[model samples]
Target: MIKSYFIQNKSKDLKSFKAMLMWIIIFTFTTILSFSQETPYYQLPKNRKQNHEMIVMPNLDAFTITYFLSASAGIRKPFVQQNGISPSAASFEAPANGFWEIALGQNRNDNWIYEFGITKSNNRLKTSFLELSRTPLVFTNEIEQYYAPFRIKKKILTLDKVSRNAFLNIGLGVSYLIKSNNKPIEEGKITFGQRPIPEPRDYTSLNFRIASSNQPIAFELLTEVRGKVSERLEISVFGKAFFRNNKYLNNQFSFTYVDGSSKEFGNYEKPISILFGLQAKFNSPKYYQYKSRVE
Candidate 1:
């Protein structure tokens, strides 16, 4: 009886092991089918009509250098002018100027772009007007000046394979006035004596002077449309407007036989400029990765 019982127990153990193996195979097959029916996130269709797209991937580090040239035109107010003259009278009316920029920085794939560079600009304007109608009159003056600015800017590019590149840039800068020239003026006063004699005296001379705080801090908003024109070359059209809370001036007046003094004149106001230019980019070989197809 003991031998028969042991044999039946052994048969029962083998049958139970076989049942477990069958269930394991069924579970694995179900899992495989479920996975095959679903699509992967990377295989999704891309929207090619958008200007910018967000990239999601592991973190990467990249470094690049850039150089650019541009031209701009804008309005500016003189920092100091004559006490009695209108601020507009000393205002710069011309807006045809040119500038150049150079930048260098590091990039992290499509995340961010930071750069520091220097810029130089010219300011020239011409207008005709009459001043000091009461005495010492001046007329038809042409003003020309140049400004040099040092600045730093930061930009973020949203990149997508199916769309064009778009980015936002914010910058802070400071500029110094090099030289300012305007039309010359001369005026005199007459005196009456017992013999009816005439006395000559010069009233005031107009000179544009830059102050110690002549350096102005400015800000700008920039937008651009970008695309890769070639394998290692990129082309873009960008626009920007610059502004500053500080003012430029025209002071240092001279009087005949009198002391020369400086007075706070007009404030530089409403200085606005627009730029439209093309930018080309050259890439290094290390910035790209090669992929292979398997049969």
Candidate 2:
């Protein structure tokens, strides 16, 4: 009877241990689920709370480089053509040229844009002269000059009817003659029976001061219409008018021909030039920002 009582107590102890093990498992699972709800690995969109909005900062400073092809036109009298008695002014005409520029720009609250840049242009000037009667001299001269311009432009007017980014600007700049192909008269002179008709270089005065400090200063009026192609690429069409002081010579050159013929052959003034061009501008994507909205 004592043995039987011990067996019954042992069975009761085993049942109690199974019940305790089940309770411990349930408690552990509950604690883990509670912690997971508080701190999750990733948050879902539906679980996000209200009153949290993302903000994007504006791009205040950006850099751009432009490659453009422009055509220039002006009635600039840079040389003189003379026959026997009457002297006339010969105008120089320019063809289309290419320019490369690098600029840094500042955007002010999407209202105004300020730009400063350095540009270089390769230009060709053409003019022809004909003395069809007396000396029978006929010739055409083509001259080349390289210009390096440092400029700053400020926005003056915005055309809201045309586009959001269309604007007019006024520019102040200075340009230096980096190099020129001006040859001496002795190489291309023509002799007519003891009178030597010198080349254009002999009649045109040379500028001894060709440095950057002695560059020509100018003001420009320009209008630009820009279109965005992508986040980093933009295309623009622009028209500019440049009003500059004398770009080359300051005084005229007077030369006496072989038959006691004298004429003034140089003009110290530069005319107003107009330019029309298309440009492509590039910028970095880091200068722009994108925002996400969560409601």
Candidate 3:
């Protein structure tokens, strides 16, 4: 009887072990199948288009240095030394600036641009105008002056509705003004092929004069209307203003006679003025990585 009882217990235990092992295998297979089935968060409607693609730009990209050279020609249109009458008259600006830009970012509207340019920085625009207008000089000559302005600027952008072809950028900047008179031409004579005339340097005209006093600072504002006119070519109109330092820029030339000698006098005066010009921007080709995933 004892041997029969032991045999029955052993058989019962073995059957239970096999049954448990079978259930475990079935459970594992069911769990794996459920996980393997694709389950998206949501499904699109049936009427949607077959292809939906998006383009992404290099929004988070390293900065690059931008090399640019701008040629601008400016004149002192408002100097009164030779206005033909009265003591003086106020003048406006025809300042042309040649700019070289360096940038840390991709030169987008969100980043600032540092500009160092080649300019006439001609402080003697008035004196030069006086000589040209009064000296009766009839010779062909070139007066090359040197000047430079250093500035930091950023762009504010806007969009247009018509054709959606144009964009506007307004810039705000400040600069340090630099002047040079290393070569002051006084009563210089030039000869045309057949005609020779007196182009006096007239440096003696001013009594209280510093050839080129360092006029070092200013605030500026500028705007650009930009658009793509052709393939890979962009054009823009730029307008700017140097609004500060108004008190230091008087065009009035004072004349005084002492001991039977007439003398012209001026201070360290500059012109606070407006500027307008055109700009061309080149757009290089942009490359992007296309990625695809099935939902």
Candidate 4:
């Protein structure tokens, strides 16, 4: 009886040990599979299988410094009138403007990009001849002019990865005009003592105040596609728009005659613009990647 009892105890111990070993094996296999499934976020190539690492590209914590040259043409229609003049009745309408912009900045690992930049635009109104009929006589006049503004812009956005080399961008920013120059205009002529003389003198100043006390802040949405076209060349295209209030442009103007007489002019509404441009990035891909990591 004693021998039988000892044998039964030994058998029970063996069964318990086997069960524990089985459980250990199962747990070890599960842990290995889980770790294998989650590769390092940056280790996978663009064509890798669908996994966490492949779904979200590693955050490149690096600053990307880019400078681009862009030109854009847009129409500006005034919404408000000034100095007893309606926009439709003005000397010119919906003039064309060309702009140049430069930007410098960095991108965070979270896909947020912050940039400060500047843009300059030169615009001109078409020259035209007009005749004013007064009770005493009729006078002929010609309007010719150009206007330009320098603006400082600050921008912030997040890049939503759409593909290996593409992203959808949403941004917001503010623009402030540093300076503006207007075209010169000649008033009508004055005839005194049977002699015709140039009257009011041609004045050279900005026709409208493009910059106001209130800063022009706007939101931007764009889709950017970037890829390496060559060993040192990367290209991207962006479509952008800006929306803002016209109140900031509320301009008050006063024109004074040589005789010390002046006329006060009210404000005119300014139009917004939608712009598109292409950018080329020149640098070593590894440099960019490393810079991104540092950013």
Candidate 4 structure quality by residue, lDDT tens digits, 84-147:
4422222423344445555554444324545556655543323221332222221111122222
Q: Candidate 3 versus the native: TM-score?
A: 0.43
lDDT (Cα, tens digit) per residue for candidate 3, span 1-295: 9999999999999999999999999999999877666322112222322212112122322222333433444333222123223233323332333333321213333235455654453333333233324453221112234434555545445465544446766666656545433433233223222225423322223222223323466666777676667424666677777554433433333333322344343332335566666655554432223333433
**Which prediction has the highest lDDT against the true structure?**
2
Give the lDDT of residue 16 in candidate 4.
100
The local distance difference test score of each candidate is: 0.43, 0.46, 0.43, 0.43
- TM-score ranking, high to low: 2, 3, 1, 4
Put down candidate 1 lDDT per residue, 176-294, tens digits, no spaces.
Answer: 55554533432333222222442333223344332222344555655655556543455556666666443232222222322344233322223455554454555442242223233
Clashing pairs in 3: 74-94, 74-96, 75-94, 78-91, 185-201, 186-201, 187-200, 187-201
Off by over 4 Å in 3: 1-105, 109-123, 127-157, 162-164, 176-179, 183-210, 243-271, 287-295
Score candidate 1 by TM-score against the native. 0.43
Candidate 1 off by > 4 Å: 1-92, 125-127, 130-213, 249-276, 286-295
lDDT of 2 at 96: 53
Give the lDDT of residue 278 in candidate 4.
68
Superposed by TM-score, candidate 3 places the C-alpha of residue 284 at a distance from the truth, in angstroms, of 2.1
Candidate 4 lDDT score at position 250:
43
